[model samples]
Target: MPQMSPLSWLILFMVFTLSYLGFLTMNYFSTFYSSKTPSQININSTSHSWKW
Candidate 1:
């Protein structure tokens, strides 16, 4: 088999690294992010299912 050059190896590593980072970034943001703020949540709401 033929040996790979340093430049070729560097390019390959960069491509793979960038692609992997991009994949992880995509997965990190794949979840549903809510835009609700503190004011949107009701403090006195009786939505709790537990009783004291």
Candidate 2:
């Protein structure tokens, strides 16, 4: 088999890193939002009750 050029190797590395970062970012946001929603709902209810 033929060897890959340096540019091709660089491109492949960049694509892999970017995809991995994207996946991590997506997972982080999903977990963050999931944890945040309950607190937000509680805050909203508390604020609404305080208004009365």
Candidate 3:
């Protein structure tokens, strides 16, 4: 097994932190723009009863 050096660990941590921050920022903006209308509809059909 290979072990990462201190500098490598630091760099990996920074990259992960930045990526997480970017994801959070995107989610924040999405939430902000997610609700503009008041009405929503969802339809689900689970039965097949048709007359021919």
List TM-scores for all candidates, in order.
Answer: 0.54, 0.53, 0.52
Ranked by lDDT from best down, the candidates are 1, 3, 2
Which lDDT value does model 3 have at 37? 48
lDDT of 3 at 6: 79
lDDT of 3 by residue, 1-52 (tens): 2475877889999999999999999998787455544346445658999999
Higher-ranked by TM-score: 1 or 2: 1
**lDDT head-to-head 1 vs 3, winner:** 1
Q: Is candidate 2 or candidate 3 better by TM-score?
A: 2
Candidate 1 C-alpha lDDT tens digits along 31-51: 788899998987885686788
The per-model lDDT (C-alpha) reads 0.89, 0.77, 0.80
Per-residue alpha-carbon lDDT of model 2 for 1-52, expressed as tens digits?
2466877889999999999999999998787434556546654334433554
**Candidate 1 local accuracy as lDDT?**
0.89
Off by over 4 Å in 2: 1-4, 32-52
Candidate 3: clashing residue pairs, number:
0
The local lDDT score (0 to 100) that residue 22 gets in candidate 2 is 100
Indicate the TM-score of model 2.
0.53
- Most TM-score-accurate candidate: 1
